[model samples]
Target: MNAPLSLTTPAVSVDIAGVNLSYGTNHVLKDVNLAIEPGEFFAFLGPSGCGKTTLLRLIAGFNQADTGHVRIGGRDITDLPPWKRDVGMVFQSYALWPHMTVRRNVAFGLEERGVKRAEVERRVETALGLVGLAHLADRRPSQLSGGQQQRVAVARTVAIEPKVLLLDEPLSNLDAKMRVQVRRELRDLQQRLGLTTIFVTHDQEEANTICDRIAVMNDGIVQQVGTPMELYERPANLFVAGFLGTANILKGRIVGSGAERYFEIDGGTRFPIPEDDRIPDGAALVFRPQHATLTDQAGPQDGALSLPCIIANREFLGASIRYGARIGATEVAIDVPFQSGKYLFEIGSSGWLKLWPRSLHWLSV
Candidate 1:
C-alpha cells in the first residue's frame, strides 16, 4: 500500500484588512477585516447576496477588493494574480474536466507549474490516494458519483500544495445523507492536512459543525464573529440573535424599577426583570425556543420567568416537540424533548411557559 500523505503540511495565516467591494452602484462587502490563524478551519456564513462567497473569491484572487489589502502568512498579495498567490479554491460546481482521467485532473495544476515528470507522477498518485480514489485514477469525471467528484476536486486543490485552501459551499451539490457523511470526511481530511482553510456557506449547521470559528455576515456587514457556542448562546445583537438560530423575540416595554422592576409585553403579560437600570424602557427580550419549558402550572420558581400562555400549535418532530404559544398579544415558540407517554397539551390548551431569567437576552426594539 502507498504511504498516506503527511498531515504536517505547511499551514499559513490569512489576514484581510479594510476590504471593500462594489459592482457599479451595488456595494457588496464593506470594511471587512479578519485575521485567521494558521490551521484554523474558519467559516464565512450568511444568506445569499450577503457577500460570503464574494469574500472567499477575494481571498482566492478571483475578485479584487476596491479598497484594501490581503496578506497570506504576513506577505502582502493584493496585487498578485490567482496563480501567484499559492491558494487553491474548490469551486462550487466541482469544475472537473469531463474528458480527462482523475489522475490527469489532479496533476494538471502541477504540470502547468512545470514540476518535473517524476515528481508530478508521485504527487498525482499521492493526491488520489489521500482522497481514497487511487484505484479510480484512470476513470473520467463522468464515471464518479457526486461525493467522489467532490473529493476529486478537493484532491486536485490539495495536490498543488497551496498555502491555503478555499471551499465555496463544496458540499451543497450532494444529497442530504451524502452531505453529512462527506462533510465529516472533509473535516477529517482538513485536520489531517493541517491546511489553513476557509469555508463559505449559508447553512448555519454546516458552519457550526465544521468550523473552529465563524464570522456571521449580513448585508455587507459582519454581524458577529465567534465560536459556534459563543455565537449561538451570546449573540451580539438582534440580527445575530435572530440569524444564528430560532429566537423568540418578545417586544415589550420595561416598566417599574428596583426590586419590583419588570418588563411588560405589549399584549398584557409581565415578566420580572431583576435589573432594569441598564435596559431601555422599550426593548425586546429574546430566548431560544429550546431553553423554554412548557408546563400546565402557574407557580414561579427561583431564577425563572413564568408566562401564562395557551398552546397555539404543536409539531411532532422526530426527536422533540415544538410548540407555539400565545402570551398576551405576542406569540412565542418553545421546544421540548419528545416523550412517548408524556402528557402533551393540545392546540388552544391553557398552559404556562417557563424560561430561566439567565437565559433572557435584551436587545433594542
Candidate 2:
C-alpha cells in the first residue's frame, strides 16, 4: 500500500499567486492566492459557482488566468497545457468511458502518454491494486457500483503518478452513506501515496472530515483559509460564520460611548460589549447556537450575557435539542444538551438565553 504509484518526485507545493480569471464581462476568479504544502490534503470549500472548480482546473492547466502565475513545485507551469503540466484531475462526474473495462479505463492515460506496453500494464495493475479493485479489472464501468466507478476514476488519475491530484466534488454523486465510506477510503489512499491533493467541494462537512485545511470561498473570492475548527470558531466575517455552520447574527445599532459600548439587538435588550473586544463598523453580533443555553430564569450568570427570549419553536435533535427563540425583533437558535426525563421548556414560555461572553464575536456585514 505504501508508495505503490512509484512517483518520480516527492510531493510538491502548488502556489497560486494573484490569479484572476474572467469571461468577457463576467469575472470568475478574483485575486485568488493559495499555497498548498507538499503532501498536504487541502480543500476549496464554498457554494456552487464560487470559482472553486475553475481554480482547480486552472491548477490542472485546463483554465488560463488573466493575471498572476501558477507554480508547481516552484516551476512556472502557468503556460503549459493540461497534459504537460504533470497534474491529474478527477472531475465531478467521475467521467468514465462506459465502453471500456475497469482495467482499460485505468490504463488509458498511460497508453496516451506513450508509456511502454509492459510499463502501462504494470502501472495499471498497481493502481487498481492500490484502490482494492484489481479483482474487478475485467468489469465495465456500467457493471460496477457508483462508488466503484469513482475509484476507477481515482485509479486512472493516480496511475499517471502526477505531482498534484485535484478532485472536483468527487463524492457529490454518491449517496450519503456511500459518500462517508468512500471519503475515508480516499483519505487513506492519499496518505499512503503521500500525494499533495486539493479537493473542491461545496460540502463543509466533507472538507472538514478529511482535508488538512480548507480555503473558504464566496463570490469568486477567497474569503478565509484555515482548519475546519478555526473557520468555525473564529470566522473572518458574517459569510464565513454563517456558511460554516448555523450562526446567529443579530444586527442593530450601537449605543453609548467608546469604553461603554452596547449592542442593542433590534427592539431587544442591550448586550454589553467586552472592553477588550473591538467592534468594527457595521459589525453584527455573531455566535453559534451551542454557545448559548436556555434557562427558565435569569439569575446571576457570571461572565455571561442573559438575553430574555420567548421560546417560539423547538426541534429535537438526537443528541441535543434546538430551540428557536424570539428576542427583540430577531429570532435566534439555542441548543441544549438533551437529557431524558428533564422537563422540556414549553413553547410560548418566557425564558432566557444564557450566552457565554467569551463565545461572542463582533463581525462586519
Candidate 3:
C-alpha cells in the first residue's frame, strides 16, 4: 500500500478577521473568519448568494476586502492586484478561448510572464500531461468534450504554478456521471501535486466527497466546519443538520439528565435522551432516516421513541425502501433495507415508528 501524504507545512493559510462586504447597503459577507491547513483540500459549501464565490475571489485577488486582511503563505496580500497574486482560478464557464489551441491556452500565463519559449513549452506539456490532456494539445475548446475542456482549463491554471488553486464550481457544467468522474480525478491530481486547493460549490455531495474538511456557509455566515463524517454525525445546529443531508427533527424539551435522562416531545410523548453531555432544558431532537425504524408491532415500547404513524406513501430507491408516514399533521420519512423482504406497507396503513435514543441529537430550543 502507498504511504499517506504528509503535509509538513501549510501551502496556503487564510485569516479573515471581521471581514465584511457590502454593495450599496446590501451586506454580502459578514465578519467571516476561517483557516485552511497546507496541502488540505478545503471546500466552501453553501447555496448561491451565500458569499462562497465572493470569498474565493477575495483569495484570488479579484475582489478586495472592505475590512479584513487576506493572507497566503503567511504574507498579507490584501492590496495586491490579481495578476500580482500567485493564485490560479478555474471558473464554472471553463473560460477558454475558442481560437486558441489547448497547448497555446495552457501556455498563455507563462508566456505573459515573459518565460522563455522553451520553458513555457515544457511547462505547458507537463501541465497537460498532469490533466490527461497531452494527447489533445492541438484541439480547440469547441472540439473537446465538456470533461476534456475542463481538464484543459485546469492545465492552464496549474501551468502557472500558483501558490493556491481556487475553483468556483468547476464541474457544474458536466452531466452527473462526468461530474463524478472528473471530481475523483481532480482530488487525485490535487493530492499528487500537494497543492493547497480551495473549492467552492453548492453541491453537498461534491464537497463531502472531495474535501478534507468543509466549511458550511449560509447567508454570509459559516455555520460549521469539519470533516464529512463529523459534519454528518454531529451538526452544530438545525441549519447545518438539514443542509448537509435529510434530517427528521422532533420538537422536544429536555426534562432530566444522566442515567435518567429524558425529553418530552410536542405530542406529549416522552422518551429517554441520548448519551450526551450537551443536553440542556428545552432542546430539540434530530435524527436521520436510517436512524429511525418503522414496524407494524404494538403501542409505546421499551428502548424506543415510539409514535403512531400512518403510512402516507412509499418509494423504492433500489438499495432501500423509503416510506413517508404521517405523524399527526407532519410527515416523517423512514428507510429500510430492500433485501430484508419487509412487505411494503400500503398507503393509510398505520404502524409504530421506533427511533433509538442513541441516534437522537439534542439541541437547545
Candidate 4:
C-alpha cells in the first residue's frame, strides 16, 4: 500500500537530452530528446519494441542511458539511483504483494523510510480512501477485482507523494469497459494532485483520450510529438500520418506548371494541389476517409474533385458505414455516417466521390 498524497508538492518538469541506449547491437533508443512540462499528463505512444517503455524506464532510473542527460525540475539526475529520484512508477503487472493487505502495501514505502506509526496509519487510510478502496484495506490483492488491484497499485504509488508519476500500461490488464472507466479516474486523480505524469502505452485510443500530448515512436525512434488533434490533422511525415489514424495514401505526380498545376493519379484521375509552395516531385496525396463524400453522380464540383470509383466492399460500423472503393489502380476508403436506411450501394456498384481540394494533404513519398 502507498501513503496518502499531499497536493502541496509542486509538479516538476522533465527534460531528456541526447539519450542513446542499446542492448549490444540492437540500438534501442536513438538520440531521443523531449521536454515535458510540469504538471502535464504526457504519453509515450507506440507499438511494441518501439522503445517507449525503455524511455520510460530511463526516466525512472531503471535503465541507464549510454549518452544522455536526464533532468527533473531542472536538476540533473541522470546518475541518480531509482529510490533517490523521487519518481513513482506504476508498472504494467500491478506488482502488488499478494500476501499483504492493501493497507500494508500502500504503507510499505512510508514504513521503509522510517515514518512514525501514527503518521503512516493516517496517510495509508487517506491514500486508500482517495482510491475509493478504504473499505477494502484489509483485503488481499488476490481477493480483489482487476480494477481494484489496479487502483491498489495507483494508491500505492500516489501515497508516496513522488514528484513525478510514471505509468507503464497500467490499464492494459483491465477489460475494455473497465479500462475506459479507470482511465477517466486516472486523469482526474492526476489533475487533482497536480503531478507531472508520463504514461507509456501501445494503445492509440488510450493515449488520445487520456493525455494532453503524445510522442509517437517507432523502430526505436521518436516519429512525431504533438497533441492528438495536431498529429491527426497535420502529421509531420508518412509514418506519422499512417500510424496515428486511418489515412488513404494516394500516389500521384505533379503535372502542369504555376496555377494550372495538379496531381494526376496513375489512372488519369486528377486533383488540384495547393499553391504557394513547391510540391515534391514524387509526393503522395493523403486524406482521411471521412473527408470524402460518395454520390451516384460522376461530376466534378466548383471546389471539389470528383473521382470515379467502384464500391468493392462496405462495412457497417454501427454509427457510420465504411466503403472500400477502387479508383484506377489504387484503392481508397470512404466513410459515410449511417442514417437509418440511407441509400445503400451494392459491392460491385459504381459510385463517384467528391473530395475537397483543401482536405487533401501532401507528403513526400
Largest lDDT belongs to which candidate? 2
Error of 4 at 118 (Å): 1.8
What local distance difference test score does each model get? 0.90, 0.92, 0.85, 0.90
Q: Can you tell me which runs of candidate 2 are displaced by over 4 Å?
A: 1-3
Better of 2 and 4 by lDDT: 2
The per-residue C-alpha lDDT of model 4 at residue 124 equals 84
Name the lDDT value of residue 346 in candidate 2: 92
Model 1 Cα lDDT, one tens digit per residue, 183-281: 898899899888899999999999999899999999998888899999999998888888898999998787777888888887778978876336754
Model 2 Cα lDDT, one tens digit per residue, 58-100:
9998899999999999999999999889999999999999999
lDDT of 3 by residue, 1-365 (tens): 22332233447765666778877688888888888887889999999999999999988887777888887878888889999888899999989999999999999988999999987887887888888888899999999999999999898998888888899999999999999999999999999888889999999999999999999999889989999999999999888888898988878566766878776666666666556547656667788999888889966566777878889999999999999987765687898888766687899898889887778787655
Count of backbone clashes for each model? 0, 0, 2, 6
Candidate 1 similarity to native, TM-score = 0.96
lDDT of 4 by residue, 306-331 (tens): 88898999999998999999988898
List clashing residue pairs in candidate 3. Answer: 10-38, 11-38
Q: Report the CA-based lDDT of candidate 4 relative to the real structure.
A: 0.90
- Model 4 clashing-pair count: 6
- Tell me, what's the RMSD of every candidate? 1.6, 1.3, 3.5, 2.1
Q: Name the lDDT value of residue 132 in candidate 3.
A: 84
TM-score of each: 0.96, 0.97, 0.92, 0.96
Ranking by TM-score: 2, 1, 4, 3
Which has the greatest TM-score? Answer: 2
